[model samples]
Target chain A: MPKAELLDPQGQAVQSAMGRLGFSGVVSVRQGKRFEIEVEGQITEERRIELEHLAETLLANPVIENHTLTIE
Target chain B: MPKAELLDPQGQAVQSAMGRLGFSGVVSVRQGKRFEIEVEGQITEERRIELEHLAETLLANPVIENHTLTIE
Candidate 1:
């Protein structure tokens, strides 16, 4: 998701829409990106490390976003 | 995320880029949208149900995406 301190226009837009639709329980929203990656064969320790590195460097913008990787 | 049977051009593009970047462990990638929502006060059982309804009707595109909600 965008940094906590950053203004998320998209999220704000959704929140506004929700309010218009009468879902008042929602206080705020933050939109984020998700990726489900497939790797052939077993995910060994080395592969896990590589995947984390790739996710940080290529999939997510570290400067503006925080990312997490999970094995199914 | 887009349905598994559906083609995700964005994911395909990313996979191709990964190949070019020499991250061969990646077999495929499926990109999806995420949202972090905050609610004022504690989440009661009724609120949980309402949140689930809201997520299905407003937050996710049920036709092409599946969504899961968790209380973090």
Candidate 2:
């Protein structure tokens, strides 16, 4: 999830636009990015670990973002 | 979520970069945006419906993306 208030500019802009479009009461909003990866085989324990490492090191910038992995 | 292969270029580039960085077996990757909104009050049934409509019409572009709302 994105750090609260960090996405303020973009989130606030979107909120304002939504309000103008008749969507009010949205106290706040935070926006971030999501990634879905299709691996070659079953997502085993080792693969999960590797994906987590990759997510932290490559997909997300630890300084301002966080990531999660889910199988579906 | 972003349309599957639609995120190909960016995703593939990330995957390739990861491989070079010693992380392999990631057959494919799809990247998308995530939005976390903090509403003003309790998310009742009516609020949920309104949020859904807002997400479909404003937060996400139906033509090429999908979204989900969760309370946390």
DockQ of 2: 0.75
After superposition on all CA atoms, what RMSD does each candidate show versus the true structure? 1.5, 2.2
Q: Which stretches of candidate 1 lie over 4 Å from their true place?
A: none
lDDT of 1: 0.88
RMSD (Cα, Å) of model 2: 2.2
- Candidate 1: give the clashing pairs: none
Residue A22 in model 2: shift from native, Å?
Answer: 2.5
RMSD of 1: 1.5
Interface RMSD per candidate? 1.3, 1.4
Per-residue lDDT of A1-72 in model 2, one digit per residue for the tens?
666535557777888987898867888777778887777878889878888888898888888877777887
For B1-72, candidate 2 gives per-residue lDDT tens digits of 766636557777887887898866777777777887777878889988888898898888888887877877
lDDT of each: 0.88, 0.79
**Structural similarity to truth (TM-score) of each candidate:** 0.90, 0.83
Q: List the residue pairs that clash in candidate 2.
A: B1-B66
